[model samples]
Target: MSDTAREGDAEGSGVSEGASGRTDAHESGAERTAASDESSTDAREPPRLDGWPLVGNTVEFVRDPFGFYDRLESRGDAVRYSVAGDEFCTFFDPDYVEQILVAENERFRKAQILRDSAAGFAEQGLLLTEGEVWRDQRVRIQPAFTPEKIRGYADAMVTYADRLCDNLADGEVVDVGDAMSELTLKILAKSLFDVDVAGRRAVVREATAALNDRGDASGASAFLPDWVPTPKNRRFERAMSDFESMVDDLIAERRTGDESEYDDLLSILLDAEGPDGTTMSEAEVRDQMVTFLFAGHETTSLALTYAWHLLGRNPDELERLRAELDAELGDRRATMADLPDLPYTDRVLKETLRLYPPAYVIFREPTEDVRVGPYHVREGTNLTLPVFEIHRDDRFYDDPDEFRPDRWRDDFESELPDYAYFPFGGGPRHCIGMRFATAELRLVLATMARELAFEPTYDGDPDLTMAATLRPENPLEMRVERR
Candidate 1:
């Protein structure tokens, strides 16, 4: 079960979530006033959340990350510790998360763990790069995900969802998680690659799952070198080899085929100019395609999985959601234009993300010394910002653990800290696929809810496991009833 303990409350301290400038020394000093006695710096070191010797917090964290981070919040705003011989100071404050991700972004880079974890598969993709390289790649890729372009895929999303649902019977039990996975992948492949992956869906799913599981396992073994061929590493290598081969075949086929009718993301990426004004190389294009394939579908599927599970647990909320969908899109499929009218559906997605953000935690490393709250973190020190913990912090949320989409019905975005609910992350590195994912989620939910009402058979919240994204420990099995 998820822990709901409130060990300490250091409210009204730290930089204001909306503060425009880097946190001033005065503010940092003021925030220190609320730090626990253990955090006081007479000893000249930050408060350490000590764990088992040598291996440190690695084992415990891998075993129960949610509970470990939940308990750490009570320790202090900045809690220092060693995991796998590497020192880290986790910042549970939104102000700190914003500083690292935005205002002082230039002073930090993507965490080594994140880069290493995705390196072999997503080598030099936008997600792992920093500095001018990332800037150029972002510029080149930005056009493919604009509002207008994403809207163009609406019909494809609805069409694919309908087709997927056609395979379901009104009274049969289905693995909702697996179903969503296939549906989202099909939609992504058709809309972005302009290809149908229905025949290869199982291969793509299996490969992605293996990669994610291996990534999570590698992350847990914090100090292990990437070159080491552990069992999980070997599995990842095999999966990557298969995934790359498939992606290569797709790219080669697209290259040799006629381009006059091509208007998909792959075509745009191929035609995009690099910083030097030359066309991107085939290798670069392949890297980007692989990155998008994994990102564009994986987390979105997980979000849908969590949405159904959350709705099933809260029938009243589910009813309200269904009412909105029924009234706004009665007996009709949802289009991109209708998304604005489905306020309750939007709120439910926001609430589901708040409770179970797919990209739940982010890791970073400072390029220079940084002062966050009362602590002085040295340059190159690893820092972790747990969005999962931050979202549930009582200072920013009421009854933070409860499911309440109603909170978003109000102008909660303006009322709360900007960083409080960053499901897509923040700053320049914010997910480029944000617009596409939102439109896809809203449209899929509208279509699915309009056609069928799901009744989850499980008794409690779906068990969570740490993967490339947070996923259910088991397939989200539910009884599907056509409406």
Candidate 2:
């Protein structure tokens, strides 16, 4: 890891030294005074990265977001950089991350960029809503994710995994990413809506691909105006329209059926009431469905995809995983009851999440001027919690980039800082489906490892793309070998 203190002291670095250090070179005197009075401390502005005129750091960031954030880590814990004309402060220190996500969470709101991007699909859902709306939605949706409810979904998860494994032929080359996406989507459909999405898989896949293209920061669509007739934007609109139609069909079908016959998440949303004794509106229900459908399946599939990729490259790890599965679940499918004895399987998933977090970054904006460490951040300044960069930081883990599941075998997590390994994020706004996703990952991995092994069809690392989720830039092809 880079020396945090030494980086701040480097010549020409924008980071201030102490509470009494001078303000950022660009900060107006009046603005600096207001920040000092708000915090009643001599907090200076964080370090700033120099970029080209007008475009700023947008080009570099668009070119390679992971590399861009990695470069920022060498500047200081808190570094300011711009994308296009918009400025954002990224926090690298775990303590500051905790403050932003947990300690002083109320002082920040979900970043506007995220809201704008998601507005096309899930505007009123738990992912984008704020204040009363978010709180109520979370309250209404909490019951479906309780420990008992999640455990109940394990059978369906394992069943779907077995189905996928059975469909694959020995020595057949497969697009592992697509296969995982299909498996998780099926698992999610059954667990969340109590329906089969076998027929709608193509639509979901198309819509998800379009969403990724539209939301990807590395693409030109990200910087263009919404009204602009960009090719990607046009495709996104068509895909969303089809996707919304599918959601409407699901909702309409459920509305016409006996509500008491179903006990999945869709039914919960349909029957839930707020403190005011009102149920969600039609549009709100659609938003919730879209939110869960996208968020729930997409992240878990990516986790499984990356896990397969990593395990395929590491034969020793693959053998270890198979040994654990064979010992715990020999010739039988995995169940929730067997999770405790499958510690190695759990560690493999954890290691994969650390290396390739689906939600790479969490964006938040301060609601008011606040002091973060020795830095004075103004209200509405974008705060980025780079989960991807932090996960791979050498400061937190030894050989951070290597895919070694056994690293999690000891008290490593117990000794790590709170926000150092937050793959699902932290605080009040963390991923609500965390438990569900983890359970799905472990069960699917166990079932697949028990019956088969994967061998990579390509060489080196598959190129990675960043958007709302971290995914491979190309199809991750692998050969399916029956164990």
Alpha carbon lDDT of each predicted model: 0.75, 0.81
In model 1, which regions exceed 4 Å deviation?
A: 1-45, 217-223
lDDT of 2 by residue, 1-483 (tens): 101111111111221221112222112322433443455256789989999998889999988876888799999899998886777999998877766665556678998777666658778888888887888788888778877888999999999899888999999999999999999999999999988999998888988998898888888568776667788778888988898899999998988988899888998788899989999998899889988999999999999999999999999999999988888877887888888799898889889999998998889998887887678887887889898888998988999999989988668775776678878765567667877887889999998887887799999888888876888988999999997
Index of the highest-TM-score prediction: 2
For model 1, how many clashes?
Answer: 0
Clashes of each: 0, 0
TM-score of each: 0.89, 0.91
Error of 1 at 196 (Å): 0.7
Please give, for residues 1-483, the per-residue lDDT of candidate 1 as tens digits: 000111011111112321222234224433542442233343344688878878788887777777778778889888887767777778887767766665655668888767766758777677777888777787778767766788889998999888877777888998998889989998899889998887877668877887677766325542466678887677777887887788898988898989767887898788877768887777778788888888999989988888888887888998898898888877888898888788888888988888998888888997766565556777677788887888888998899989999988566765776467777765567677777788888888888876776789888887787777888878889998786
Residue pairs clashing, model 1: none
Which ranges in model 2 have alpha carbons more than 4 Å from their true place? 1-41
lDDT of 2: 0.81
